[model samples]
Target chain A: GAGVSQSPRYKVAKRGQDVALRCDPISGHVSLFWYQQALGQGPEFLTYFQNEAQLDKSGLPSDRFFAERPEGSVSTLKIQRTQQEDSAVYLCASSLRTRVEQFFGPGTRLTVL
Target chain B: GESVGLHLPTLSVQEGDNSIINCAYSNSASDYFIWYKQESGKGPQFIIDIRSNMDKRQGQRVTVLLNKTVKHLSLQIAATQPGDSAVYFCAEKSPGGGATNKLIFGTGTLLAVQP
Candidate 1:
């Protein structure tokens, strides 16, 4: 009955450094999503995965942002050469099916100094 | 180019009073809408959802009303509690974002319940 969970609840990195954030979706979930939330703003879509296949990555801002869900359960979002603009809360969510209600993780707050 | 937005950025209500949060969406193609509550230092929590076909849905102390003609949605909470204080967001699921069911979220409304 555990919900989705993300690792490195808080991450601090110097500008130009690379960082990787991890997510563990709920067991048996087939659909996974990643979102980025800026301060005082709503969460924005980043990418999506249906099982191990990356169905969509349009939400990613640039090539520096990469995500992979190799096993259909664990996912990783990596950002290369961190920028101050990338400082935000990275959220991960999962659902039983597309369009269904999603369970969200606590999120990994990444700060680029 | 379509987006979701809240009519108000902040809402304050006394405890035990009814509260209403309003949202306006520009994507008419959107077929599903959801409400989420997020507290500080946490991720969004699903509250209730309403399909496009229906105008109204109720869950616990929360009720969601959808107005397709005006492209608007509203969440009504009965007897608001202090615990309900958080950022409330309205999200719409529409095609053509990243996948078949991409959700576009609205600017959240900070709900403050006074005890």
Candidate 2:
């Protein structure tokens, strides 16, 4: 794709269920990032990946949140035992290089019931 | 609209008028700065960006002004339109520069264009 692509534009998960969201970055992009945006809030940083290496996971709110970019091109965010507070728009972005402008995906709106 | 804590102060402008949004970043060591526009229920879309070395950068119909002294940033949009109505965010990625990235962002500001 010419741009970053994310799956399941909208996801509805029952509390305590596990959900996984996927991101496909632009081809050969070396940097990928995950962010969580709450209603009426700015997107908060989650984790960052340089190719297949996870360099930062400090922004993750809980241990239940996990992310992996096995090949550096595609990534996934998994939330285990979801809670209502976890509901938000999960965004994925990729940049040709870091510190440059990043391309953002459409984002997945996750709603926990 | 509800305001986010990290969000920048908002500016309301009339259609065909100019709109200005501002940001104050806490990190002075931050080397790169960017602006993003996000509509409701969507992710942020790239706006324009300026590096610390430069005081100004411009894009079509948009301009970015940076002041290192006060650690402030601003986005200027000429002839604001209804299509320009959305939340604007300012992001900073610091000295650990390269593809290894993390952007600390401001909360965002909602630009309301009155016709």
Candidate 3:
């Protein structure tokens, strides 16, 4: 597949539980971004990574949210002590360069019960 | 607290008719803009893009018009089809976000193409 991939496609976790979502970006992509999309709203930026460097995370909603791309090819977003408010579709996008067009993944729908 | 936003929340059009979606941005420094379409259960797919320097750009059956003076942007779809039913969003790249070119997305407009 030439496009970005994410898993698991759907996740349901109890409140206060911790969950981790993974994103596999397009090969050789230099920039990867994470976004959160609530129902009826456009995706909101959460964080960004340039290879292994986390250049910005200004959009992260809370300290409980964490993301890492240790190898720079694959990234993971972890939410600790999840709350109902954390439920949303988590989207991942990749671009060949910074500030250019990006390709997005199908996104992982996370449901906090 | 500048942000991108859309004028309409939903738009319905008959097949073969044209469709238009509009957006507004508060940041004048945004140098790039893009439009994305998201079908049910799918991620947003890029439709078209226009640089701040240009007023209009066209793709397949889509056209993007930029009004820098008013900070407004619009996407026009020709001969709307059933496949065109989706939520459309407009995004602007923030100039101050360094090389990352962080994109700020607007509230999307749901386009419903009816037969």
Task: Give the number of the best model, judged by lDDT.
Answer: 3
Q: Count steric clashes of candidate 3.
A: 0
Error of 3 at B16 (Å): 0.5
Better of 2 and 3 by DockQ: 3
**Chain B TM-score for the candidates in order:** 0.96, 0.88, 0.97
DockQ of each: 0.78, 0.75, 0.84
- Chain B alone, TM-score, model 1: 0.96
Expressed as tens digits, the lDDT of each residue in A4-113 for candidate 2 is 99998999999999999999999989889999998877788899888899988878999999999997789999999999999999999998763477889999999999
lDDT, model 2, position A23: 98
What lDDT, from 0 to 1, does candidate 1 have? 0.93
Clashing pairs in 1: none
lDDT of 3 by residue, A13-54 (tens): 999999999999999998999999998898998999999999
The better-scoring model by DockQ among 1 and 3 is 3
lDDT by residue (tens digit), candidate 3, B13-107? 99999999999999888889999999999999999999988999999999999999999999999999999999999998877778776788998
Best by DockQ: 3
Which stretches of candidate 3 lie above 4 Å from their native place? none
lDDT digits (tens) for residues A4-107 of candidate 1 = 99999999999999999999999998999999999989999899899999988889999999999998889999999999999999999999874567889999
For candidate 3 chain B, which ten residues in a row score worst on lDDT?
Answer: B93-102
The C-alpha TM-scores of every prediction are: 0.98, 0.92, 0.98
